[model samples]
Target: MAYETVIVEIDEGIATITLNRPEVLNALNSQVFIELGEAAEELSGDESVRVVIITGGDKVFAAGADIKQMASATAVDVSTNVRPSLRTFNFIENMHKPVIAAIAGYALGGGCELTLVADVRIAADNAQLGLPEIKLGILPGGGGTQRLPRLIGAAKAKELIYSGDFISAEEALRIGLVNKVVPADQLLIEAKKMAQKFAARGAVAIQMAKTCINEGLQMDLDRGLQYEHKCFSLLFATEDQKEGMKAFLEKRKPNFQGR
Candidate 1:
């Protein structure tokens, strides 16, 4: 689909969502959120798309929210205005297919929150990620507060958010915020490689695993285990499961049709 602020390209089974607007460092705005949500929704229903990658081109992921747009907002306006971004983030987080963040340059404030929604994050060596809303006399209105702590750790998340300090891509990897970091030129290549790996897997199983992990996080250990048991048992009814076992015994790769 064509979008004014973002571009969605599907090649093979991998869908790439590029955050356009390099002129402003790809700042997050209301229009961007709406387009992103629409694109994500469209991709979520596409059976051909097995995995997705969200990037801000090669130069920058995004600097932050459009500060100028929010400079004069009142409390009521601010409260109601953040719904689009929050809704978009939630859609991305709940999408069945895996989503990867291919981050380069700065992914600050809203941009960092954006990456938190992805299943995996691969950063360029020159990337800088942070929640710098504190510097703007605001806090991360997008899922940053909840997701960041769950991802890295409360202490580390708090340090970065409170101080508004941008961490290098290496530091982000060390803290487990990012899965891998490569040279700037290789960021998209690595991200697409990871996406391709996911594309090759059993689609139903991958979706189930993502559900178990994401939903299980909100449950206690006992409940989470039960939920996983149910998901595992349910998978036995799929055609892919039979093919997978048969292929294993025959020493051949199982051809999954995403059934």
Candidate 2:
């Protein structure tokens, strides 16, 4: 679907959603948030799309939220305006398929929160990420407070959020915030390469694995193991599971039909 603030492209089982507001350095606003949710929903329901990537051209992932849009708002107005974004972030985090973030330049505040929902993140060497909302007398309204700590540990999360300091891509990688960092020009290529690798896997197993990990994070270790075993046993009923094991024994590539 065509979008004013973003671009969606699907090719060879991969869907790429590009944040397209170069004039404002892809600063996310309410409209951008709504479009992102719509695009994510559309892609999630598409059977042909095996993996998804969210990017902001080569220059910048996103600067932050469009602060000017909220600078004049009252407390009640600000509360109401952020509801859609919160819902959208939740949807992306729980989506059935894997979601990858391809980040380049500035990714701050809401932009950084957006990346936290992605299953994997690949950043360019030029990337600068942070949660600087505290400087503006606000906190991350997206899922940053929750997911960031889960990803990089509570102490590191607190340090970054409290200081409002930007971290280099390499620093982000060291903290486990991003999975990989490549040269600026190779950002998209690396992201697609990783996506292609994931796309080649059995869709059913991948979905189950993602669900197990995401849901397990909220449960005790024993309960999480029980949940994982249930999902593991359930995959045996799928055709992909049978084909994958058979092909493994035969030393051949398995053709997964996503069944």
Candidate 3:
């Protein structure tokens, strides 16, 4: 499907969603959120798509939310317009297929929050990431406050958010905000490589594992273990699981149908 603010491409078993508003540094807006949610929903329902990558042009992942859109808005306007946009992030996070963020340049405010929704994030060496909402007399309303602390630690997240400082890709890596940082030119290549690795796995198992990890994190250890156990046992009923085990016994790579 064609999108005005974003581009969606599917190849092999990977789907890539590119934010296409470079004129404004690919700033997030209501339209961007709408398109993103549509793209994610469409890809999630496609059986052929094993993984999804969200990215922007080489110059930036996204600078931030469009300030102009919010500048003249009242609290009621923001609640009516901006708040609903967060559903896109939630959709991406809960997608059955893993979502990877290939970030370059700046990923600030809402952009940073966007990356947090991805299952994995790989950034360019030149990338800068932060939640600088406080600098604008606002706070991150797009999951940054929640996901950031979960990814790094609460203290680090607080420091970054409170200071409104941008962290280098290396610093982000050190703080565990991003999975890996590569040369700018190789960012997409690395992202695609990781996506391909996921594509080759048992799709059902991969989705189940993602569910277990994401949902399990919200529960106590005992409850989480029980949930994991249930998900694990449920997979035994899938053809992919049976094929995977048989393939292992036969000393061959398994062909997963994602059933």
Candidate numbers sorted by lDDT from highest down:
2, 1, 3
Predicted structure 2, TM vs. truth: 0.99
137-243: candidate 3 lDDT, tens digit per residue: 99998988999999999999999999999999999999999999999999999999999999999998989999999999899999999999999999989999899
Q: Write the per-residue lDDT of candidate 2 for residues 44-84, one digit (tens) a residue.
A: 99999999999998999999999899999999998899998
Q: Report the C-alpha lDDT of model 1 over 96-213, residue by residue, as the tens digit.
A: 9999999999999999999999999999999999998898888988988999999999999899989999999999999999999999999999999999899988999999999999
* Candidate 2: residue pairs that collide: none
How many pairs of residues in model 3 come into backbone collision?
0
Overall local distance difference test of candidate 2 = 0.95
For each candidate, give its TM-score against the true structure.
Answer: 0.99, 0.99, 0.99
lDDT of 2 at 44: 98
Model 3: residues with Cα > 4 Å off, grouped in runs: none
lDDT of residue 164 for candidate 1: 94
lDDT of each: 0.95, 0.95, 0.94
| Per-candidate clash tally | 0, 0, 0
Position 11, candidate 1: lDDT: 98
